[model samples]
Target: MEVATSNPAEETNVWGGGTRPLNASYGKLMMWFFIVSDALTFSGFLVSYGFSRFKNIDSWPIADEVFTHFPFLHGIDAPMYYVALMTFILIFSSVTMVLAVDAGHHMQKGKVTFYMFLTIIGGAVFVGSQAWEWKNFIKGEYGALETKGGQILQFVDQTTGKRVALADIATPIATDRETHLGSNGVWYVSETELPSVSVAEVKAGFEANENVVIRIQKLDENGHKTVLSRAESLEKINAATTVVEGANLIHNEYGNRLFADFFFFITGFHGFHVFSGVIINLIIFFNIIVGTYEKRGHYEMVEKVGLYWHFVDLVWVFVFTFFYLV
Candidate 1:
């Protein structure tokens, strides 16, 4: 048999293989390719979102006004904090995954298991938080009166600059005529209870409420909105309400329903990715616990999954900035 003894340098070169061009292992190489394609997919969604935002630049919903909620602090005016927290949790999970990969490299199974558990916990928490966010958005707050012109006319206090509810601003009606069913007139199909407040009532309230003012969806020089004074706004509202019909894209209290559409698509897609990633990580976690990698004599599986987890974190970083921040 050949001599068993070997020079330490030769041993180092064989096991520690010097860096080569595209020197990554098979698993790592695959991770990079997947990340590239995934990055492009995210970019496509973001670019589409940008296109819509640009088209409705005059009347797009302000992200801050729409997403301002924090857990345990009801009506606190804490915009973007909840989403920011979710982003941090995902980033932290990525950190844990990196640590697990490092531990695996040294064959430290115990460390790998510990870090993997942390990673799973972080992912679960993030997913749950995202669900909570969607719930609040779907169930809108401070509902407004929809005008015939499709423009959302919000009641803002001239003194406070806060949104007042349709009920609070409108006088109590003895008998509301907003019925979905055709009770006496031409009827073939059924109807239901109409919106809480109607255009007619809104016009009447505008005449009565002196403190109330209206802000149209038009853009100013700086791209921000201009809110009209009570007297001026009432005149414009009366003029616009006369000829307006059922809502269209140009008019709606929500500032282009497309805003809601994009919000759902972009955020929903990202959330779905997070969900699938959690499932994948769960599978890997179970394998780790059962000594799958211990038998295989390598921890490449953890490394590969770690790359995906990090890429998700990276995408969220940009999403938060563009969607929530600037």
Candidate 2:
């Protein structure tokens, strides 16, 4: 006697008569849920960022003025252009990903391979651009002076309209000498290059540079930096440059530490997300080339991944608006 077996293909037959529900495979459902949770996590970060920005509304540095660097545009005030370009690249990659999914629907292997390759290229370029941005930020421009209270103070020259470094203005009051170095006394450890300009150096630079002036933390109702006219600034300094002091969270030579901190954290987190998405996409792309999905006779995997790629692009849209735009 032969035993009857249920057919996998027969599961969808109605009127046998119970119809099988068109259930999404486990992988696709899990991906959807993961994307939703991850989106909430990002939302929490952005909401916190918004709160901080609101709390410090009056003193926050204008985002446009702060991040204006663009590739191949030396010294041009091309604010938002570079980041906009990065956004376009990611969005275009999402488009290609969708097209790849469409081709996979028709079982077009060659087209899928081509589009996936393009997506990978776009992701690589975006990651490289982000690295360049980080380098520029970490190196910093026009540099700020850190106060005893850890605030930042920035210097500007009225004539040059450029940021002035503290080192350019002030000479440090050298301390007592000859408390020399030795393994026992205070062994020298491997040292890293200092990241910021010291406040004393900023003061000396201010005195040395004829065009330089100080911008104090306190501003009038109009939101301008408390400035001294060139002559008055020099006169006040000569009388007593002791007005110079350290920075705090409330005040800093660079502008606001919170601004810097928020910038580093938010963009850094977004960059990390982009990095992970690229890795996942690459894995899928390789699988396509190796015939894994085609052998299964279903391209739903490509569609699912396309959804994720689009979601990444969507997150970047908000990030650009908040971080680089208004």
Candidate 3:
């Protein structure tokens, strides 16, 4: 009996292993795999953030209050303005990446180079803006007092209904204490830089300023920090043990410590991805300038990087929503 012969193409098609799936190259397919895994990782982080915020809804820092900063406009309450600008820049960069990929597809070297350059600039700007934001966050504007019960007590001017800076409210008192060093104290132990004002100084200032009142982390019915009466402020101020000026892994003046932790982690992670994308885009950009893809007769490399750039931009949209808007 003669056996039926199978065509190689038919066998390959049936096995579905040797051919490009969905007409994508091996490199493109691998990039897609990476994007999917990275997306899942981001989702997990965001979900944890959501759960933490929900669990501590009352004490969680309000996004508007925490992100009220604008470049070159210090002391202005421009809530979410700079962050919104950063979001726009990132999304616009994604647009430029698309144009670059399209130009590559059309074999227009000049157009591809121009768009790639714009994309790189946009990514760099976004990374820089994020660093500035982190600086402001860590340095803090209005300092707070931390109680023995881990509660953050912010001072507000009842007259202006606005938060007061530690500098404006703190009374300078002489202190002989200095930061603990490894040499002076325990051989291996050292203390972080001391806060600008001491608790004693803050207490004196609060006592002197009748316009200032203590604002607890808990939100009121109107969704604002709960401000105490003069009598209540005096009572609450006594519980304060330490002065907390800014945010770190150990403490946060913004309300809950978890807010700062998640902010740094998620935003820093996304910033790293943007930074990496910028580097990759630069490499592809130089290759284009050198006519590498031209000799190869395809700009498929640009298209692959474009995919990654789009993914990065999309991820930032979610991050912006969760961290700033929501």
Candidate 4:
């Protein structure tokens, strides 16, 4: 006698009109799908960054030189120190998240709550650090001169081989400077704010300081920015069309405006993800507090959010490698 048999493939298929997929709850399976698609999206962004970086290999900004600012160290030059600390904090938070998930598995609500709280604090600190970084980038440190041909020329001390800020080297000038706003000039064009110093002021300062020379954006044989001769420095500063104080989509004190664009886009996207993960973590935290999951007899929500938090931390690892170390 031939008996009808259930099709295993049909039973396992999620969209084959099956109720449960691979014994996964609908929510868990949906989260997995979202994570996979998001991974692909991040991969695309990083790949594009790599290609662009290779194309602009000569003029790319050095990450250490760019991210050297540390909190409460106004005059200190500590390259990559602060960012390394931020990385450590994030990794430690990931460890706490792992403990949270393990506790959830054991149905230990108290441990889960404590670990989740620690994770939230770590995430908050990371976000705040990122904001500080952005502020410094936007404000800039040592100012550079932008040539008409769209190249940056930084100032350095010939004796010390260290960068000299325009604020320090430039002579004070009193001029009737007016920032042309939309109401005062073209309807579509306006200046955000006048640069702290003018090109004329910078020129006067550079000419007077015999110890200072110009460091053009072009790299030398040893993979360092090329420093011009005293005479060349004078000639190079003459081509200065504008003062580039900080980074923006239009102008970057760092080499290659494209670098700033990609930095903002990729980092901003990742920051948004961290922000979202924190919100979700908070919700799960409250649920655990109210014994919602304790009643339902499972703590799958905590596990799901843990997966997301781990992914976020993992993404930052790649971002820190490429954006800072590499």
Candidate 5:
């Protein structure tokens, strides 16, 4: 072994010439690797969503109809307005991150801190907006009926050609039904809270409201939900077994249950990413205020975080296009 012994240090050296590959430090390179892996994960989710939507294209919930709510704009039909604002804020935050990184490169601590503060604010606002959107989605506006075969039957005013909420059309009916609890019978069994309106109440209301018609989940050639004739609506309403008020893992008043499933999973996952980025930005922002990066003689940490922020924004672009625009 003494004749030609290999040097352990040389053998273990991954970077042949230097630790910085392509002028990127180890931390920056690692961030790139993490971003690539994360991008692949998001791609997998979006692909699965595309396949599911394609299979149930006709029954898929219309994005405009589902995301019509805006802050303090009750009874207003503003489709995609709030969602577009959220997207704009996120993208603007990415721009601020770029500015912060550029300022850091010039050793301009003041500019870097200012831009970082702006970026953090934008991210926080976006996260809050996402939470608001989730609240509205889980507590759906207009209610619908679910058939035994899992089809959704929405109500619409024939004269106005607009959706009608169950609260407006559903008659109040007294019932002795009660929510099932684990302590009531089986120790491990329980039922979810009962819906606000019962199926029988909705049926009676439908009968009383002659102007309301049933809108099936199936889309017509014009890309709108198929509205049934008055006689057909009566027949279709008879097939409904349950009144669904909001969306959950099991039921969605909008349309196909799978649409809700994908919406929750994909949007929830993306929202988590945005929220994590915000927290990380806050930590970096505090460090900047404390002169941590200034003492280090470089702002490479800011650049590293900037890369992650940009990746989050880019992923949202794809998500927005696929989920809302497409």
Candidate 6:
């Protein structure tokens, strides 16, 4: 008989076979590396957003005012409600992922499939809800006037102290307006579709309505926009150069243009991640359905993807806090 001895190697050696580095398999370890790098990227975005917001804290659009739309309840001021539901859906999906991973550990194919299916449904709903939110944000509710200096001035009824939509206040003008089209003008440049309300129409309506007042983009100590007086409103309205109906890369009726820019960039970036996660989940799901993992003697693949799904959910927590709560 011959005595056998085990070779000693540091756990930190990723290629070492004696011990698993960080007590994780190769796939899980790689997933963690990816998560850490992605987390740093999101941290940079948040830090930059914080600095920009601090510089213009007073003038920043209130989250409540900006995210007031709900799924089917039009004209209802249900602020932070829809987004709360979206957050819950993500969190719930994360829970289902945990269950699926546990089921995989037990080699319960049926349970794993069920939980994975639920997770996929949750992810689909979340992505769809995000699309709806973006649509509403871009379309916007009320329109505003853009000055030559690019300042936004919204309309508010002085008596009610509530913001009014351009549709409700704009008087129809009788004039044949020629739209600026790319083919008609310079071939290299093109203009967007015209706004619903015209500058002339807005001016005419404001002049005729005694209750309407000008709300400048600048916010007062109370965090509300600075409402110009009857005399000041007339002077401010005189400087209007264009009619900006909604948000774009250049203009935003909801205060700072940078706010909208950050909103689109960061949220769009996160949405892309969610979309990718959903696609990945679907592939893994199909693999599991086809007994690919069952024949492998283990379900490590499910565990690996669960880690990624959890990371996506965790990132959204920070995003929700910064974009909505804070």
Task: Supply the TM-score for candidate 5.
Answer: 0.93
What are the per-residue Cα lDDT tens digits for candidate 5 across 1-326?
01223566765686554333366677888999999999999999999999999999877889999999999999898998998998999999999999999999999999999999999999999989988988999999899999999999999999999999998998998899899889899988887788888999999999999999999999999898899999999999999999898899999999999888988999899999989998999999999999999889899999999999999999989989998999
Over 4 Å off, model 1: 1-21, 147-149, 174-194, 236-254
Worst 10 residues of 6 by lDDT: 1-10
The digit string of per-residue lDDT tens for model 2 on 1-326 reads: 01223676665564562342445666777788988998998898888888887887766676665677898887787877889899999999988998999999899988998998898889889889988886766555555554455434566778876666555666666544332335436466432323233435445667667788755544558866566677766554443321222222233234566766776677778888788878988998999999988888877788888878888888889889988887
Per-residue CA lDDT of model 4 for 202-263, tens digit only, reads: 99999999999999877888889899999999988989999999899889998788888888
Clash totals, every prediction: 9, 22, 0, 0, 0, 0
Poorly placed runs, candidate 3 (over 4 Å): 1-13, 16-18
Better of 3 and 5 by lDDT: 3
* Per-candidate TM-score against the hidden true structure: 0.81, 0.78, 0.94, 0.92, 0.93, 0.94
Q: Cα deviation in Å at residue 51, candidate 2?
A: 1.3
Q: Local distance difference test, per candidate?
A: 0.76, 0.70, 0.92, 0.88, 0.91, 0.89
Q: Write the per-residue lDDT of candidate 3 for residues 1-326, one digit (tens) a residue.
A: 11223568766575555543376777888999999999999999999999999999888899899988999997889999999999999999999999999999899999999999999999999999999999999988898999999899999999999899888989999998899888997888888688888999999999999999999999988888899999999999999998998899878899998999999999999999999999999999999999999998989999999999999999999999999998
Tell me the tens digit of each residue's lDDT in model 6 across 1-326: 01222554544564655654365677788899999999999999988999899998888888998899998899999999999999999999999999999999999999999999999999999999999999999988888998988788899999999998888888999888877888897887777677887999999999999999999978898887899997899889999988877788889888788899999988988999999999999999999999999999788899999998999999899999999999
Residue 118, candidate 1: Cα error in Å is: 1.3
Off by over 4 Å in 4: 1-23
Q: Number of clashing pairs, model 3? A: 0
- Ranked by TM-score, the better of candidates 3 and 6 is 3
lDDT of 2: 0.70
List candidate 2 segments past 4 Å from native. Answer: 1-23, 167-191, 195-198, 217-253
247 in model 1: Cα distance from truth in Å?
15
